[model samples]
Target: MFWDLLVLVFYFIIVFYFGFHFAKTNQKEEDFYLAKKEIHWFFLLLSLVATETSSLTFLSIPSLSFKGDYRFLEIALGYLIGRTIVALYLLPSYFSGNTISVYEYVGNRFGKSPQKTLSLVFTVSRLLGDGIRLYVSSLPIAFLLERMGLNLSPEILGMIALTILSIVTIIYSVVGGFRAIVFTDVLQWFIYIFGGIFALGLLVDKLDISIWEGIKNLQTSQKLNLFVFDYLPSGDNSYFILFALIGGAFISIGSHGTDLMLVQRVIATKNLASGQKILIGSGIVVLVQFILFLCIGSLLYLFYSGQTMAPDKVFSQFIVAEVPSPLLGILVAAILASAMSTLSSTINSLSLTWARDWGMDRWFSPRTLSLFFGLTLFISSLVPYFLIQTWEKGILEMGLTIFSYTLGPSIAVFFLAKGKAELPVSGLVFSVFFLTSILSTVAIGLGFQISFTLLIPIGFGIQIFLVQISRLAFKKN
Candidate 1:
């Protein structure tokens, strides 16, 4: 326990020291939020990976692999393909103007109301979705530590972890801004990826199986198959394959293309070409990272088949139970680093969105912006206190599902904005309000899942038809 605390303290010190070091001198809003838009490609690529990957993958991907096999790669492929499309079409437009918030592009292309509405949606979705995500990501560690006589309450343990993470992340984000976040994220990515690979090698040794044999076993178990139509839910119906493909694509666009957290790296780039490169380079990095983690997950399940009670804990438990104390310390550091890297990105992104889109700079005085930021973070953190849960998912699918809501409304906003067609503000509001209500209620309450094919068509159909009707009515008059 003493050793774990020592390592955790040292790791956090490095983060705070760097954050304060960067922000020690004069501080400005642009420097604080956008890092003065002077980031390099390599660092931006790393930040992109860190922002998108999150700490959840560290624990969850291996758990998924333990349950099945390479089937998870299908989701990775979807994101890779989807991001490539975004790199070509969407990124250039974001660069076209010195846009601060990506959703602002939606407003410029659409109108004020749509932009503001989507910004609000992004904030709500991320805090609820990613807040729960952050909570769940730390649960595996808390569970394993408790079992080892570290004996902390899960809620208490989670809070302690979140507090450390928030402080370390906030220091750099609030001070050094995007540049600090990206540079640190690049450093942390290597720690996370390398630590995961090391754990994977250790797991394979314990399994008494070569990695190739494990692959063969997983293939024979049908965990390797990407297309699973065996049990179709009502919404997916007969079009399961098509649904998987389309839904994956839409979810990816909503996440990588529209979400501000993911786009911050692009916005920080020196030029449009650099931004495009960051998107493509980061997309490839994510693909490789997903494969590495998924393979580790497979190895984890194979080794610990009957020994562990919960499969979710297999990956982190191996680090806690089997790895030597010093190495264990390093693993914990890596996990916290991963978590802090992502949380910092989230806070900075949320702050930027609020400050810019909400007109905080103009509407509020300097003192008010400071107060608003603190208040917003305080309110956002309250989410995990009430709603964190322990459900598990594969790294890719888990991210996309959380991403759907964040991306969905923004997609509608951007599509309208880029189309530059006059959309009825009333109709736009009604369409977003209705779609959000139905999707949230059905998906959460009734447990109904609609495939992307149906959801996208319906969501866009309503918005477009309303706009067209308004146009015709005006002409007729």
Candidate 2:
């Protein structure tokens, strides 16, 4: 335990030092937010992958496997189909606009009222979503290590881990900006992928299960089904596979192609070609990463010999159960690396959006930005009750649920080009209210899987219908 903690402490120190060291080079808004448009496509690609794979997914994937099999891959299939659509359609829009905040383009197309409204919604939703993700990643380590005779409650341990992460992230984000986040993500990406491979090797060798045998075991257990047609009986609208294909494509196009966190990387590119390349390469890399984690999840079932383990905690459990203590420590560091890479990327982007879109520059100075960034992260780390529920229930459902609820209204404002709609301020304010209410009701009440994937197209329908109706009525007068 002492040795393990020692290695982790050293790792934290190294990350902190590196993060601060890079900050010395950041000086302007472009430097702080977009890495001054100097980031290499390769680094941006890794950062994109890192940002997309949250700690929630890291822990949730194995838990998902334990539930039935590869039903979780349904989500990945959706993501892949979604990314291809995004690369072709959404990528060109971002490349042509060349904006800092993706929301700005929406504003440019429609108006400011809609732009700020949508940006605020995204920031709020992402903070909640990523906050849950951070807690999910940190909690297992806290729990597992505490059982091994460590001294800390799960929450405190969770917070401490988050604090360490925030400090390292702040150091780079405050100083070096986007470049630092992307470059560090390059290093983290290697560690996480290598660590995932190492964990797989440990499971296969330690459990006496060859890769083929592991697959065969899962196949026999009926955990390998990738398609499901069952839904509430008598319900004719039960088309999850279709939703996964169609809804997922639009959701991906909107979130990855239009969301600020992602577009910031693409816009940071030296040129439009490199920007497109980063999206394409990152899409491929993310798909491979998901496959690797999914395989690890399947292998974990064999490692445990069918004994019931906490599904969400199962991935970390395999590390603690199968790997030797020393290597387990390394893997733990790698897991933390996975989580930190994401947390850091988010903090950096959040700061950029807050400063640029919200006009933090008009209200406050740089020192205030640093303090506000830290405060926002601290506040965000506290909202993980959803993590407990998601863990107890299932990962895929929780993620899809979130996407379904938030994506519709966000997409409505964007594709309809309603950013600058005439405002007594009511139009912008009402749009935010409309989207949030619908998303909340759908998420909490309707409870359909992949709701946003289905609803986004519907949102477009709603937008166009409203526009035509309003125009016709005006002409009638």
Candidate 3:
């Protein structure tokens, strides 16, 4: 335990160093928010992956494969397809002018009202979705401390964990700005990826199983199954391959193309080519990372045959109970690294959106606004620790599902703007209401049980259809 604490402390010191080091370079608002458009493709690529992957990816994804199969890879493939389309269609527009926030494009195409409205939506959605992510990130820490004989309740431990994460993230993000976030993200990405690979190797060694033998066993058990061609509207989240593919594509579009958190990183790159590389390259890295963790989960199943646990808790439990001391600490730090990477990005992005879109920067410095949003996210992160017990789904799915509620309307608004149409504020409101209403009525009120996978595409279609109808109605008037 002492050794583990030491390693964790060392990691944070390095993160703080980078944060302050980068802060020395901040000369203006653009430098602070966009890194002065000086980030290279490689670092931006890694930052994109790190930003997209929270502790959910680090901990929950392995649990997913441990409890189920590898069918989620289909979604990763869909991510690749979606990213390609974004590179071809979306990246050019973001780079076409001196755009700071991607919502600036909306203002140019629609109006200031829509741009600010969309920014507000992005801020709210990010708060809710990443709040769940922050909670999920605390689980491993809570489990670890509990195993070390801490006498606290899970809720107490979770809150403590979240507080620590928030403080570290806020300090760096406020001081270091975007450059600090991106560069540190690159470092965190390597640490967690190495941790995943090391854990798998350790598991394989402990089980006395050869790689091929484990693969053979997993294959025989159908645990390694990668594709599902069925279309059951009410089936499990992993079974509907077609919907998963389409849904994955739409989610990627909403997340990578429309979300300011991600688009900020893309536009920070030197040129259109660099931005394209960041988008497409991140998809590939994410796919590979997902496969690596899924394989680790499969190996874990072989190691713990006949044991039953909650899918989300399985990986963390193994780390606490099974792994040896210092290595255990390293893995825990890796989890912290993953969580902090996403949290820092969220804080920075939320601050940028608030300042840039709402004109808050004129009243307050960007650093001050960053601290403000960081605190807001920290408070929001605590909400989930109390509420997550009532949720029936895994953290990853729940977080993604929450984003679906707003991402569809967001993407539709962007697409509408691309067509140079003036979208009314009422039309934007109606789009969100209509899509969310249909989603709830069909899936909850009527109990037809549509898969969460289909929500984004369905929502996007609804928004587009509504916008077209509004356009036609305006023409007739």
Candidate 4:
């Protein structure tokens, strides 16, 4: 336990050093938000992957595979397809513009009101979604402390872990700016990957099974099954392959193309070509990373002989009960790395949107705004502590569902701007209301059933239909 704590302390020290090391370089808004557009494609690729996938990927994805099958990979394939579309259609507009905020394109195309409105949507959605991620990241740490015989409530333990995570992440993000976040993300990407590989190795060794034997075991149990061609409207694991593919593609486009959290990294690249490489390459990397963790879960399921456990708790439980000392600390650090990477990116992007899109720069420096949003997000992270206990779905699914509510309207607005459609504030409000209602189970209350996968495209279609009606009305008037 002592050695494990020592390793954890050492890891924290290294991360802090990097943060302070880059603190000297942040002299302007660009440096603070976009890394001065100086980031390399390789580092940006790593940062992109690390930022988009939070602790949800690190901790929850394995649990997802353990409880279910690898059919989720179909969504990843959809991600690749979606990113390819963004690379071809979206990157050209983002690259053509010189502004740091991607929503600046919205303002240039439409008006200031929509830009600010969309920025608010991004901020609120990220706060809710990544806030849950920050909380989820601390779960394993809380569990680790409990296993070490700490007598505390889960609430207290979660608070302790979250406070540490927020303080450490905010200090670097505020001081070192975007450069620090990206560089640390590069290091963290490798650490968590190594941790996943190490955990799989330990699981195989302890199970006294060869890799080939484990594969056979998984195959015989049908845990290796990766595709479901049937269409089901609602059931456990009721994902239809066709809907999954289309939904996955639209979600990816919305997330990577429209969200500033990712587009910021893309535009920071050296050129259009580099941006394209980073965007598409990150999708591919995400696919491989998902496969790796899912394999780990499969191996773990074989090791445990399919004993039922809470899906989210399975991987963390293994780490605490089964992993040896120093390596346990390393794995914990890896989890922290994943959580911090995403949080730091969220805070930075949120601050950037505040300063650039919302015009907060008129009142405060970007640095001050960065710190402010960091603290705001820290508070928001606590919200999930109350909500998570009652959640019935896997953490990964819950996070995805929360974000899906906003993705459709957000992406639809982008298409509106791109088409030069003139939409009023009421039009935007109606779009949000319509999308949120239909995409949610609330639509069932209205006697309609909408699959989650179809939400984004449907929302996008709705926006287009409304815009056309509004245009025709203006013409008649």
Against the true structure, candidate 4 reaches a TM-score of 0.93
- Each prediction's TM-score versus the true structure: 0.85, 0.86, 0.93, 0.93
Q: Name the lDDT of candidate 1.
A: 0.67
Q: Order the candidates by lDDT, highest first — what do you get?
A: 3, 4, 2, 1
Evaluate all candidate structures by whole-model CA lDDT and list the values in order. Answer: 0.67, 0.67, 0.82, 0.82
Task: Give the residue spans of candidate 4 off by over 4 A.
Answer: 233-238, 386-400, 420-449
Off by over 4 Å in 1: 24-26, 140-152, 227-241, 306-309, 363-402, 424-448, 451-462, 468-477
Ten residues in a row with the worst lDDT in model 3? 437-446
Ranking by TM-score: 3, 4, 2, 1
Winner on lDDT between 2 and 4 is: 4
Give lDDT tens digits, candidate 3, residues 1-477: 878777878898999999999988888899999988888889999999988888878887888789889998989998998899889997788888888999888877765777887787778778877877887788777877787789989889888888888888899999999999999999999999989999988888889778898789888888988889765555565447787788888889989999999988999988999999889989999999999999888888888888777887788888888878878888998898888888889888888887888888889888999899899888877765555555524544555566766676677777776775466446356546445544543454126455666767766777777667766887788
User: Residues 1-477, candidate 4, lDDT per residue (tens digit)?
Assistant: 777878778878888988899988888888888877888899999999999878878887888679888988988989999999999888888888788999899888766766887787788778878877887888877877777789999899989988988898999888889999999999889988899899988887898778898788888878888888876546633257887888899999999999999888899988999999998999999999999999888877887784877777788889988988888999998998889999999989999999999889889987898899899988877876665655624544555575566677677777666664456446356445445533543343224446677767766676666666666877888
Residue 276 of model 3 has an lDDT of: 91
Between the candidate structures 2 and 4, which one is better when assessed by TM-score? 4
